[model samples]
Target: MYHAIAQDIIKSIMADEYTTKLPTEKVLMQRFDASRNTIRKAIDVVFRHGLLRRVQGSGNFIIKQPANSGTILNLSIGFDRAAMVEGGPLVSQVVTFDKVQADDRLAGQGNIAVGTELYRVIRLRYLKGTLYDLEESYFPRTVVPFLSTDSVQHSIFAFLREAYDIYGSTTENYVHQVRLNDERAALIGVPVGDKTMCLDAINYLANGDVFNFSQTFFVYPDLELYYHTENIDLQK
Candidate 1:
């Protein structure tokens, strides 16, 4: 009975444009002839779902509708490839940008010689104000002649595609689940030993030449990863 009344109250507020204080407990008690415990329980339900936010010395306000409970999509394989599709806002804050020597791991991923000059870029990504993932990317200097912090701030993929005409499509992708270490946890603002998703992807050009490589760690329990394949009929 409380749930039914709560739902009606929520619906009424959502439908109306006027912003007014919710009726006091006394009014609600009279309207529904409900006990104090029942009224409190109804309010508690909405509060836990983020549909209501309480202000100090003020009444509860409807800040937003209840958020969708489940995993958000964490699309990685280089931002360029991911940006091709349209959905939600994709924002990235550059953490580090510098040139570095291609170590064994970097060389193997980019298919380049050790000690080759490579551009390293690190970014933290968010979805609707919630921290979602952290990414570290490496690019061959030969492919991207020059890069600047300002240019990347706008959109790294846009800068690459328009200025250098360097674009990458995913050739291979690897994903796994692992516990976050102290360093990684600190970077993502999560507790140490928290479960996370590790993704490694090798991106190649239209000609099959490797262009970029990346490793991304996503805050799990909030994001989900998926892959889909479809068969096409060439002959019609």
Candidate 2:
């Protein structure tokens, strides 16, 4: 019954009902002929679908829709799964995988000291053999001093977990469009005026320590982004 009510609300949303805010909980409970808990649960179902946002001191608001209405790209997933979901020929070519001294730029990005030893890994990602993303990651040597080319050729997240037992690191991502420079444009096979998106992420350990900083440049038109946020509280 709650699911039916939620679906009815979703249909109403499609019909342009409640564009900004949803009805009050008391009203919804009365309309649905359901208990407060049932209405709240139904609303939560819609909220998890990325449509509703509950603001403090305000009512539930309909969030703006993402670009990929047909497909929601989950950020919680890895590149290999997302890049080749359609079962096409996916490729990850390593451009540069070596240890380098962290310059001022790296130090600022990774929150490490200048002249710190870090492993810089750069790889070009493709979907169905068409290039679309350029991934570059920086890991402080103090964290993972040794990495193999084979390990990197597959999945860095897997390698980190299997080798270093690194798990449950918090990831922070920032998304924005950028105008590609001449060199990058040439490599990406796009003109200088073409636009690109940079997804910058920083991984941190459970103790709130920095682990790695990664930046992936994606072709805006060819790819999209999705993220799900959850609140973790131990108290009941």
Candidate 3:
């Protein structure tokens, strides 16, 4: 319920529903028919997104409009690839790990050659004892020659860095909102057709070779994401 309220409040803010400050807690509680705590929780979620600033005497004030691109300085809000090993009680359950050949489509996505050998891995992540997201990843066998259940149950990146001395140089991310399919929805304990987020990523090694391609589906309200951007003037 708080997630839904937070989503609505974010949408309203992006739509410019409020000019400077949000409604009082009493007003939001009455409008949402929720308790004061629930409303406060929802507001806190928004605040974490770098969208609002709470003034002690004043109400929640708009700090920045989230829809404005290239305006956010920094907002490191959600769990990401780096969070896997950053250590805050994260658990990973490996569902499937198999050696597979990359087909044309898979090759294109990973920027690898067709017929390339790859390790296809599917994992479910639990954050603080709750199902958080599902990740499907592929690693080129040439880059990652061996993988084990034990290694995957922890951090694959950490293993690569320690064992192979392979470090990530860059990553490209494509993110969008998506509705989960029946299988994914069931696996993540969400209703069918529930809205969530899909992040498609291509990761490169320090040697400038593509090493990993992955797609992750994040459960709503369980995940928060923030990106910092800066504007560059080409004519300057």
Give one digit per residue, the lDDT tens place, for model 1 in 128-202. Answer: 566667888887777777888887665666677668766554457788888988977888988999887788777
Clashes by residue pair, model 2: none
By TM-score, the best candidate is 2
After superposition, candidate 2 runs with Cα above 4 Å error: 1-72, 77-90, 231-236
TM-score for each predicted model, relative to the true structure: 0.60, 0.63, 0.61
lDDT of 3 by residue, 107-210 (tens): 88888999999999999987656666799999998888898888888878768766886655567778888998998888888799988878878888657788
Off by over 4 Å in 1: 1-87, 232-236
Residue 13 lDDT, candidate 2, scale 0-100 = 60
Better of 1 and 2 by TM-score: 2
Alpha carbon deviation, residue 141, candidate 3 (Å): 0.5
Order the numbered candidates by lDDT, best leading: 3, 2, 1
Model 3 residue pairs with clashes: none
* lDDT of the structure predicted as candidate 3: 0.73
TM-score of candidate 2 on Cα atoms, chains taken together: 0.63
Report the alpha-carbon TM-score of model 3 versus the true structure. Answer: 0.61
Q: What RMSD does each model have against the real structure?
A: 17.7, 10.5, 14.3
CA error at residue 37 for candidate 1, angstroms? 69
